[model samples]
Target: MANALSFTFIHVLCLLLHCSASSAQNVVFQPSFLTIHGPSMTALLYGFSSKITLNLQAIPSSNVTGSFVPPSCVPGVTQWILTSELIAKTAVQVKLRLNRSLRLCGNNETDTDCCVKPLCVLETLQLTACEGNTSQASLIIQVKIYALLGSGNMVFDNSTIIQNQVYRPLGDCPCDLTFNTCDLWCCCDKDCSTADFKLFRYRCLTGPFGGQFPDPEYQCSVQSTQNSPDWFPFLCVTSPPENNPYLGLFYQGNTMAPKPGISFGGSVSLAPALSNAYTEGSPILTIKDQYFTIPQTLNGHCVTNAPVAFLKNLDVRCVTSVQACPTEFPLQTIPEDLRAVVKNGIAVFVGNVVVDVTDQLATELNEFVTSSDIFGSSGLVCENVTLALDYNFHWKENGITGITLTRTVGSVTLKGNVSLTTRYSAMFLSGDIMSEPNSGNPGYQVGRPVIGGILNTSIGNDTVLIARSPMHLWKPVNSGICSSADVRPLLFGENSTSGCLIPVSRQNLTECSLLRNSVHSLQGALIEATLVARNGHPDALTLADWLNITYVTLNSSGVEDSNSSCADIPSHLHIYLWTLVSGFVDGIPQKDIKAVQISYSLSSWRLKCGGGDSAVCMDPAETQLLPITSSVTFIDIPLNTGPPKTRYQINFTEYDCNRNDVCWPELAFPITRFYTGESYSQALAKGLILVFFFIVASVLGNPWRQIRQIWNTI
Candidate 1:
């Protein structure tokens, strides 16, 4: 029994030792050398092992290849805590780095290969290893492995690859999927579905090699419809040429046909002919079918084409001459001695002789002469003379009343007393007048004449006597009788009165005076004629007699003294005597004759002073003669023979000199009065009292209210 038991114990001991050695020998290759089974050949490995802990080493002589350090085993757990260097190397070793923390977990004698619960063991380990010593050599991969507590074959299913999965072709290499060939979701097999194919197609289409397409409507061109044989066609192109001949052609076409109305059928064959014709005043184009004519004359030439239309019609006439056409012919031929006479717009004979017109008279003599006969007589008398009669004069015997007598050369005298009494009539004679023998009537008298009447006498050297017995005489109520003489007085002699006569003279005469009122109620006046002293002789007649006068009225208004009147003053007073010196006898200079003196009677009481009880007597004889100067001072006098000089003196004297008691000699004559009783202080006091009362009244009276009330009342 002993010998059998000993043998059993030895067998058990051997078995335990062998199992332990086998456990130690189960070291894993870091990556199970993967062989891809389909279209591609590359593979990868990942994991860790215990017996063969990877001691990553630097390649032989490269300094950049770092030295290797092995992983450590935990004392109690059947897991491994990889050193950061080893896991970091594995994580960084792949072409694309893996984002995972690797762990190893399984049963061993100690925690040699397996990792704890949350930590994963790398099934495939990839490490970058250098080939040789040189930095120029390519890098080679070094992998490590670890075993698991499983009876089946250990598979390296990378949890990092499974968790972060992507759609990659199973058998294709990662490098083969490039931007040039495929999109990010490229598949190896061609049996992809429509959706998957579209996805890949989109990726490929958007890839680098797929170029851009052209726009759909490009390369079009536009053509204009306005085309002709003369006009080139215009094209509007999508892309215009840099040096486009067609563009030039398009502008040329526009020049040919600028607007729609242009046509091109005409030819230029007759151009030279047309030019030649135009030069020859026969243009091919004509306006209104008329040949235009160039003007032959410039300014200052009378136009033969005054009516413009007449120039085209060629039918106008020209003015030949101008002549006078008289209306009424003279009745008879004037005598050869008679001066030239124009009668009824006709020029008669040009000499001095009388022509008898008894046969040519339009009225019977019948103790009268007609206007035509009288005009004929005037026509026989003067040269260049005209005569006209009123339209009422008839061609019969009754119209013979108005007759005219004219004398041009010899002195003509009226031998009979002529009387004219007619309405609308005139008696004109330019000769002498004389009373008829044994005829009581005076020369040329008229009575009670009416409208449109005149009696004009222009005598050379003659006297006219108008009798006063025909009380109406030459005095008509409304009509006028003017008599002018160049020599003797236009006289109003005995029996002639109350008529006007004007005498004109060329010779100076002594004692020349125009007499009037020689008979009763006769008045005569002369104007614009001078009465001179002849041979330095004074007028012989008194001035009052020289100018007829009767009575003078002074102070008719009774405001001035009636004793200022004088009787029989000159009717025609000379302005120089009345205004300055009387007939130059006073010898007073015009400048010194400033004022005139006159006296008026005054009562003694009127000039007295004081009240009625104690009045002082002031006699009229005591009134002073005070001369008051005018404010207007004389500057100079203009003399005919010498230079002008100021020649007058002026002084003032007060009229009421005796009123004031001051007796200031410098005060001249006028004495002014002053208030005697009141002092300035007293006046000021009174003013203040009035002012105070006024202020109180204004304040109490409510003046603004009163004003408003008054305004409202209106």
Candidate 2:
């Protein structure tokens, strides 16, 4: 019976051991207040036989409270002691504050003044009874801390087992097991373990999450970075390809040929209304039995072998008559050398004269003569006749040499020392003899009709010489007297003051004055001469109705003893003379002819004038020879007394003489009158000096004033 009791005891012991092992293998504890930031509390109860002893202890919680309580037992101990039996009888509570507040021990001990909160230590409870008989009890607690309540889950195991008087544990109660959900710590290298529970392993939704899955049709687009490798993948999946339409079927890489359509008729017939009758709707003629025809003629016209007559075999009316043939009319014959002829209804030179007989006939006689032979007894009579001679000649060949007679006249002659040199001298004569009367006009005294001539005579060395003057002998009276009065007789030597003569005693007079009145006939004459006389002699005169001199030289140095003589004639008149000169020959050498001068003597009514460097002079006393009138007047001088072929001219209108007005001075003055007061050189020098000072003052004065102003301001 004892042997049987031992076996049963052994089997009972084995059964108890098996039950203890199974119970201790894993322990579970539930947590209270599983918040993300606070500590979690898990309560564990040891499940074993009531005979076993357990030690009740407190483990420092991760988030410890300032006041902590150990695990309670059915049989409470006065002091904090842990035993195996107490553990099995009562549940052990471990209040773990994940982020615990700890008190810092220092000189300041009040809870409010504590520097730091006390840290809880991770611990395990031990129960020992006679060391040999030992068993371990473990509890597993799972705590889920979330960013918010019911957000996420976190599990920790706090299980342990005692084997051979030592505890074998899977892990500590996951001390400092933290979770974070804050985005601040969720980056690649950040510590997310301290972040809020919701931040741990958190992923962001593409759009707002309202507890519903994203729509499948509405794709969740991912924004790709510029550097992303898979950037083109999205484009390939979203877009598709399109097809082209302009392709044709191919055979062996070549285009296929299209099938042909049906053709119904060989030729179509059009109605007669749309066709030409001549063409027979064919537009051609056919010779063969073929489907086509060749065009015989274009434009639907018929081809013919013979010419066609448009109008044929019509009876035409006719009138019979006879027309006369034109007869040749008799023409008037012209006789040559008859001086006048008529041909073709035109009366040409009918006689010796080839008369130009138009409505108004103009005859030009290049060579003209006036004599009884050509003019006959009646003389050449006309209403008005103009005879123009470019140059005249009639002179005694022995006296005047190199003289030209340039006048329009009926006759010419030469007397005195006049001589002819040119072979073609017109109307030349010798000696100073007079001609006798001829037939016709028996009572007319025609001793030698005063002839026109030009004489070039030099004043000989003999103090007394005499010549008949042509100008004083027969002055040109009006044309009304040409018929009644005979021309004055040509004379030589000192005859009478009334006749044409030059006294030998008056040879001291300048030759210019002698020929001055020759041109007064107003019948065209151009005379050029050189005259020499004493300076300021008043006899030196360049006289003409109009005179133009190119140059004049004065030799006043020949005068005795005076430093300077009046080498220039002071008075001059210019009718239409254009005079250019080198310089004025003045008594004062310094007086340059740069300006015009005018001097007048009111007592004598005399005026003296000078031009700037001209070689002409006038006599102020000659004003008496001009006609006096109240009206402005012009003197018409015939440049040539001839037909329209000659050029004629007139002078400018001169105002009438006014003795009462000082402003109307005489139009004559000395040559030095233009420069009477001011020298040209002195005026020019003064002007330049004034200009120089003006420029200098303008340049220096302005800046100096500015400098003074600036100095005053400073």
Encode model 2's per-residue lDDT on 81-184: one tens digit a residue: 22211222223333333342222335555655322323222243222111124433423222222222111232333333323222222111212234443234
| Per-residue error (Å), model 1, residue 139 | 99
Angstrom error of the Cα, residue 244, model 1: value is 99
Q: State the lDDT at 467 in candidate 1.
A: 19
How do the predictions measure up, each by TM-score?
0.11, 0.11
| TM-score for candidate 1 | 0.11
222-330: candidate 1 lDDT, tens digit per residue:
3334532111122123663222222222122211212221111132111111111111111211112332221122253323212111101111111111112112212
What lDDT does model 2 reach? 0.25
